[model samples]
Target chain A: MNKIIFYNIFRFIVLVFIQVVLLKNISLYNLNMPLLYILFIFLLPFNTPNWLLFFLSFTIGLTVDIFSDTLGLNAAACTIMAFLRVFYISITVQSERLETEVTPNLSTMGFRWFFFYTLLITFLHHFFLFFLEVFDFTAIINILIRATLSTLFTVFLIFTAEFLVYRKKVR
Target chain B: MNNLWRFISKYNALFLFIIFFVTSIILFIRNNDFQRVSTLNTSNQVVGVFYSKVNNVIKYIHLDTVNKELVAENMLLRNQLKASHFNDSVVVNTVTDTINRVQYQYIAAEVINKSVNSRNNYITINRGSKHGIQKGMGVICPTGVVGIVWNVSPDFATIQSVLHQDTKITSSIEGTPYFGPLIWDGENSQIATLTDIPNQINLKKGTKISTSGLSVTFPKGIAVGTVLKAGVKGGGSFLNISVKLATNFYALQYVYVVKNIFATEQQDLENLNKTQGNE
Candidate 1:
């Protein structure tokens, strides 16, 4: 438990640093921005308490918000994502499987499951974030374009990061 | 009451979610309002220091371009010096000129962090209240107008960039009385929309748009942009003008925060007018 806490703390610091310092400057044609920091929420332990999960998500989102000067935009999106994450996990992952798997990652969850999980959550997060930032219906098409492009870009980055750390199981 | 307590305990997660979500939404609304209560923002000391430290390293990568821009601006300033031009007017023994009292003072600052891709972009600068920076001051780059100082901390300040949705600058076409508010449509960073210029006034491509000095925020006749296109929209009487912004937000580095020295006096007189008119 102590090790897990330390790992998460380290991950939080590294992810926020990379997000604000490095990834913050990179935008594909001033449209797509990869928000790989969301991976911190996704990689949390499967058995993390629902309340703890929500709190962690909110904290990370608020941290990003502070750095980006968006205030509560990311916080609102992240809370909604956390709520949906709880619902999604309850329906999909069985209690028996949770005992063996320490956390959800490419190796533990398999490619297809992990892909869909990141895709759905990321899309929803981006959709909410962009629409909320714009706060208008007239630019719905532009918002949709941005959300879709950014979602794909972020998912690609997540997959690349996951592959770098992928380890084959010696059964 | 017991049943209600039991129900609440059972759905505590939902209640927590609602609470957190509502709090965030409230925060978002408060942030969107014109006057923001600054806290937990980029202007905060910790966040500002971190960004500036990081920018100190990153700024080197653009050293070549930044140097060129500074050199170009230096040339422009050098040309305006008295030595650059022969004395065109008759040399008169001049006393201290009482006619032109300095109305504006500029403070130099460096951009530590900024985001242009977002719908409402903001810039964080190194100088803040400690350097005599304040909110509502106009910030401009060598090329053109940049933004307004929105929030100020002791050592850092955040600027509401021209690319923001709520940002509107009172501007006019060069050599014409027709003026309107310049706004960003959130589509392209390079392009902004100028509204309320009547169709009766003929506009042409490449016509320069400049600050009209109508608002107290910015000074008079600063280069804003050049007209890219102009036309009537949906049978409206006003010509919808698109302007190519002069300031390249992507390459922004240095800026000048313009402080109007007589702003308080001007505002006080305006307020007095309002009170007397009401009677």
Candidate 2:
């Protein structure tokens, strides 16, 4: 169990490095949102304590923020969404409690609920990040436009990561 | 005491929402840009190494296109040389519009795999340390700006294309010195937009825009594209202009990765100026 936890932690750190270092440099429409690192937050155990969840989420976000230097915007967005994830799981699958560390997917929960849940939170996280980066209300439409486009790309990547990492054998 | 406890229990969700919102706001306020830039700088150094590898693999597949660009450039240079001898002052404008200025140099390279369909489009080039490429180098085609070099390996380099998300260049109009941020409009690849040009600056539809050398990534006067549309942004202090990029990345082949010999000195001087201003 300890080895598995360490491996997962190692994986999370590597993803954060790739997401911000490599993918952040790739921008389209002025949006280079990170998708690989979010998987770190996605993969935490189902019944992890709330305080631990907050701490892990903050640490993950703070680490990313350290590399990107956009303040703690990533940390804030990540924590809020991590908090909401509890609600998403409870609403989507009756057996969400059964799997202790299942990353989100259609195989575990039906496609419809999973899609909606991912879509909403991803949008929220991206929207918040972009606005916080731009940090100006003079162009509200520009903010929304950036948020919308970034959300779309981030969503595409979330699924791509899931497809790569998902395994039928949870063990 | 019982009434207060009950009230707190009943409204936990609302409290959570407020607490979360306030925290985000604090983070937003605290994340000033320059410090964040340094963090990006470090990651830029590390990840830049990885993409350089992918660039090599894809470049092998696109040799034909790269050769074509080189051949075309050689022909244009040949033509210009002939014209220069005929008329000592006014050379034929085949290779460049600016005669005698030597505003740019060429380092021929090949494009491997590039993504324009994604929100962030990055292009990988086949030249790296083996070919004298490094990070912060500017890339151009015979047409215009390709991208800025972000990472480098022994045999390959990766660039953040102008078409990528949040990638902005400082640029000025062909005949005027007005500067603004040239950015890609998310919806389309053919068109990128410029912002922060004061509204007083009149930009025409056909104005040629080029890099301003405001940032270390690109040198001044390298071709970027031509303005397609110009406008005064709504209730803003600047004119929002759209430019059509000269390089047809969709059919990109060989590119030139340009290096500025004195880039390190220039950057240090610029930083010193900024620090002095703060005091």
Candidate 3:
């Protein structure tokens, strides 16, 4: 468990630095497509307590908030997504215990369940983030387009990275 | 102490995380004094180097715009020179300070940092206490007011660009002595709104918006912008005006920092008048 935690910590640092420095500049057609480093919150040990999940999620959001320079916006979005993740996992994963140190890959939950789980949570996150940044929904089409594009882009990257990270099927 | 250390170690990551995050937030909130000085110093040392490189590249691309502005200013100078009282020595007092109540004292600067895309934007200039730049001094491009100085170090100052949500200046539509606090809604940088304007005022589109003497930061009659639209909001006695700013913030490369020579004295006078009259 300590080793898993340590590895995740290392990855989090790399992801945040890259997200702020390099990937932030890769805005293609008003679409700043970043597969959030917050995916670690999604990958935390299945047995981690609920309050800890909330607190950790707040921490993650606050860190991103500090770097992004927008106060409270990203924190709110991330905390909500963190709260929703347990439900997302519960509905998709029927297995009694997530025994291995590995992440909940498609091999564990299967392709259908994994896609739904990632899609639902990623959509929830992007929706909150986009609208909060804009602050008003008068231009609904613009918000919808941003939400759709960013969510699709994030979903694509998460799936591709997950596939490469853990290739073996669930036992 | 041992028990506390053990408790901390049990949740060391969480403890550390909360500590860093709260520290940043507090630093962000209480950001105007010595903490602001340190932030400006650190950012200037780091970003100054980065911007020096960017400035080298920018200098080549901006020559045409710079030349055009200089030529226009030259023409303006010539026009002012033809005015009968263009005498050199007394001219500083009689003409430059002719604007009612407010006196203009300029601090020269070169723009080292400018960002227009962000919601809360600021421009950093290469002059500070070493060159008489001070907090609350109004900053202006050759065309019009860009922002007000919010932070200053010995060698640099960061302006709270008029584009920021925090910007509030006294502005009036030309021809009316009446004025109100003009501010940006933190949405688009190009447009700002004038609040507290009486609904009965006969203002039209294209009415030039200029600084009112109500602020010591800027002199009276300096160009602010032109009104683009006007309307009375829901059951309010004040008119809402959309003003198109005169300065092109995206292209601001150089500016003059205007200091109020009698800011403190005038502030005291204003306070005295209010306090004495109120009682």
Highest-scoring model, DockQ: 1
Q: Which whole-number lDDT from 0 to 100 does residue A3 have in model 2?
A: 65
lDDT of 1 by residue, A1-171 (tens): 888889889989999999988888788777798898999999999888778888898899999999998989999999989987887877888887665537788987889989999999999999999999988898889888899999999999999989998977821
The list of candidate 2 runs beyond 4 A from truth reads A2-40, A50-76, A86-116, A138-171, B1-46, B61-65, B82-141, B146-207, B210-221, B231-241, B248-279
- lDDT of each prediction vs. the true structure? 0.90, 0.68, 0.71
Q: Per-residue alpha-carbon lDDT of model 3 for B1-279, expressed as tens digits?
A: 999999987765455445544554454455423234444221355555555555666666677897898789878877777474545654344456555764577777887766564446667778878888878888877788888887776676778888876689889889887799889865566789999998887877899998887878888888999999999999899999999999987678878998888899999999999999998
On lDDT, who's better, 1 or 3? 1
Candidate 2 Cα lDDT to native = 0.68
Q: Write the per-residue lDDT of candidate 1 for residues B1-279, one digit (tens) a residue.
A: 999999988876688789889989998888888776677899999999999999999889888888988999899999999798888678778689899899999999999999988889999999989999988999999889999999999899999999998899999899999899999988888999999999998778999999999888899988899999998999989999999999999899999999999888898999999999999
Candidate of highest lDDT: 1
Best of the two (1, 3) by DockQ: 1
Worst 10 residues of 2 chain B by lDDT: B33-42
lDDT for A153 (candidate 2): 77
**Backbone clashes per model, in order?**
0, 13, 0
The local lDDT score (0 to 100) that residue B250 gets in candidate 3 is: 64
> Candidate 3's error at A21, in angstroms?
7.0
Q: Give the lowest summed-lDDT range of ten residues in model 3 chain B.
A: B34-43
